[model samples]
Structure formats: structure tokens, C-alpha cells
Target: MAADAAPRSLSGKVLDVLDAFSADAPELTLSDISRRTGLSLSTTHRIVRELSEWGALERQGRGPYRIGLRLFEVASLAPRGPQLREVALPYLEDLYEATHENVQLAVREGLELVFLERITGRDAVRVLTRVGGRFSLHATGVGLALLAFAPPEVQEQVLSGSLERWTERTITDQGQLRRMLADVRRTGVAISDRQVTMDALSVAAPVVGPDDCVVAALSLVVHADGASPHTLAPAVRTAARGISRALGSPTARRHPAGARRRASGP
Candidate 1:
């Protein structure tokens, strides 16, 4: 406790410094942190020292710093994060084993998706998703699955916001994205074809919670070359249903196969 410091809200500056480390840049130098967070060098140094001592950040080899294990320990206590990972890992593994491709699990966080788990096989196509990473709701398969099942008001919010483009095929037009979402809801599947990147395609399905609400989404990503989202949809949907059932979603009971069953017969 500060014996003489003025009582005030916790420092936003500290969070900014921490937020500077992300999936794209997990390690940062003092100047990098200061620049990314818009904090002064002295201020960044001071907060970095405090956070390092507290185990919320750690020093890299010489100068750069990365997020510390202590933060992950704290994050694991969150039900929406690690708890969901614990419940979904087995099914995600099954999906991975069957396809030998990239399998992902994610949840909606406002207008973006926060990946909870990811499993990739050797030789699997590279994808932009990373565990604990965030991506726009308009481009990825899992994002579309979550967005399609979201309430109409939430959908409108996304449509009204600027749609950032990542690839030429990305749906920047509101009408096109709206139609894509409709297709996802109608078929209980989302197909992202060269949307996030030109070389990857993803098929995703929604996972329901005990309340019968879309709480998460599951996906399979593969090389865009000669791949068919329709061919992968069943497997993706099956894994999603299995995870939803594990989460106590009553609707998932209607799933036609065992949770661990692999899709068979092309």
C-alpha cells in the first residue's frame, strides 16, 4: 500500500504497457513498450520494473520483456478462458487427429473473436489465429459463426462499423457480409474462403452453452488450394456439437454421432 500516494483509479498506463505485448509482438524493448503504449520512456521503465518484480512481466535475454507466466496463471482462473479450454481440448484434439489440419476454438468478445484453443498438425496450412489472440468478426470462419448467431442488434453494430480489409476477397461491403452471415445461420456453418488470407480456408460451426445460446465456435482451417469448405463442414459441426454437449447444451443432444466419433466415408 502507498503510504502517501494520492487515492485514485489504478493506472491506465500500466495496462497500456502490458497491452503492448501481443500475439504479433510478444517481446518488446523499453523503447518499444514506451512507443507502443504512448508512455514516456521513464514512465515505461518504472512500470516495467514494478510489473517485472510482481511477475506480471519478465525480462527477456538481455533487454526486451515478454508477458510472464504469472499473468497466465491468473488468466487460467477465468472460466471463459482456461476453463473453456479444459472442457474443449479433447474434442479439439479429436478434430485435429481426424483431419491433420488446423483446428481452432474461439469465443465472441464484442465484435472480435478470442481464440481459446488451437491445434495444428505437421504440414498443416498456416493460419492467422493464435491462442488468446483477437481477430475481426467479419473475416474468419469462427468469427462468422459467432457473429451469425449473435443477436440482431450486435450484428447491426458490426455492420455499421468500418470493415477492415485483409485480402481482396474480404467482404468489406455491409450487404455482402450481411448475406454471408445469413448463409452461416441458415446452414449452421461458416465458410471463410481466402477471406483472412489468400492461402487459407476455414469451416466453422457454433457451440452452444447450457442456456442454448451460441457461446463459442469451432473451426478447421486448411490450404485453400483444391480444398472444399463443404467437405469439411460436417467434421467441424460434429466437433462443435460434441463440445456444446460437454458444456451442457441441450440442443447438442440432437447430434447424430458420438462426441469422439470421426467422420467417415467421403
Candidate 2:
């Protein structure tokens, strides 16, 4: 076995300073940063100055600081994030137009699904989720689709955690979520009916990568009464297969064994 790598040393104060900024606290004063980071005022100031000079942080008009453009530029280079989104957007837009519903594209990060893009139809059902927002892997349709195809360790970790409930239909039980994931894998699609919102339903399918790993999920959320999950499954599956093909997934190059077997059955 290879030897374990040594941990790299970095000042706690520097990490603390960086951790102070969040999606909610995108901009903060030096005093606010110091309090949030639990660092001394002088140390916070020093590190903030260093980060600002290095283009990782930006000092705004008055005293607040925000993540800088340089960080955004660097983050855009991430292949699994923006790069994947760029390749999938056109296909997602097509699905949205066809269904006239809310279209979402997301990827799994740890046990959460991070929304990369969303397009809302003119008369689409309203949802609480937003772009760049993170959600649990056991709740939303995209989350379920991603969780279904994830590595076994990831599934175990999610099943072992505290599964929070969002609505009456949410799957808070580990056994139920496990069953749902198994069903998703078997059917090639996931359906979350009023799991996240009471009035909406989501249908999702996995987007596989060239390595046969699920890299993302594409979903359409529509009014629960307007469309049946069964009716939407085929469309979502087709779009997902198209995206997987574009990504060079070997599985997408051939029909699924079940389908092939069905075609050959007497």
C-alpha cells in the first residue's frame, strides 16, 4: 500500500477568514468577519488583506468584503461544475421548452445535490429551490436520481445520516430511501411527488459519464395534477440518454439489457 500523505500546514486564521463568507453572507464587514470566523480582529484584518492582495477576496466600497472575480474565474475552470453545465444547457433548455415546466440540472457533492442551473416556465409550479442551492440526496428528484447511481459507500453514508423531512411526502426513513434508490436504478428514472413542495412533482434521470459513472441529474418539476410521473418518465429518460451519449458514456451507446431482452422475448 502507498504511504499516507502528510497533512499540509496552513494558518488556521487564514482558513477561518475564508470560511466567514457563505451564500447567505456573501459580503461582510471586517468586524463581522472576525466574529463569524472566531479570529482576533488583528489576525482577521491581516489575512483579509493578504487574500485581497492575492485576488481571492475583494474589498468593496465601504468596509465589507466579498468573494472576488478572480475566484469566480478560477471556479469556472472546474470541469465537473461549470464545464459540465455548459455542455448540458442546450439539452436542458430543450426539455424545458417541451414540458413547459421547471428544468433543473445538478451534480452530487458529498451527500448533497448542488443545483447548477434552473429554468422556470411561464406557468410552472412555484418551488423554493434556486440555482447554486444545495439540497439533501434523499428528498428532491435530482437528488434521488444522483443518490441511486452513486457509489455504494456514498449510499451507505446517506442512509446512515439524519434524513430530514421537508413535507408530508418526504422520505425520512432510511429503509424507504434505500428502496427508492434501488427502484430508481431499476427504472432508469426517479420521481419525487410533493417531496420538496406540496404542489409540485419532479421527474429525474441520471446523466452518465464516459467512465460509466453518474456525473449529474436532469429533472423537470411540474404541477402535480397536470402530469403523471409515469407519463414524464420516458421523456426524462430520453433526454438523459442523449446527454449521456454526448458525454461519451458507453452505456448510452447501447440499449439497456432489459430493453434488449424485452425486444427478444416471445
**Model 2 TM-score (2 dp):** 0.89
Angstrom error of the Cα, residue 49, model 2: value is: 1.5
Name the regions of candidate 2 deviating beyond 4 angstroms. 1-12, 255-266
Q: Least lDDT summed over 10 consecutive residues: which range in candidate 2?
A: 1-10
Instruction: State the displacement of the C-alpha of residue 242, model 1, in Å, after optimal TM-score superposition.
Output: 0.4
- Candidate 2 per-residue C-alpha lDDT over 1-266 given as tens digits, one digit per residue, 9 for 90 to 100: 00123432347567667778888898999888878866668877888888898898987567689988888798899888889888888788888878889988999999899998889988999977777788899999999999999889999999999988899999998888888998999998999999988898999999999998999999999998867999887778877887887888987777542244356446
Off by over 4 Å in 1: 1-8, 31-46, 60-62, 254-266
Q: In candidate 1, which residue pairs clash? A: none
RMSD of 2: 4.9
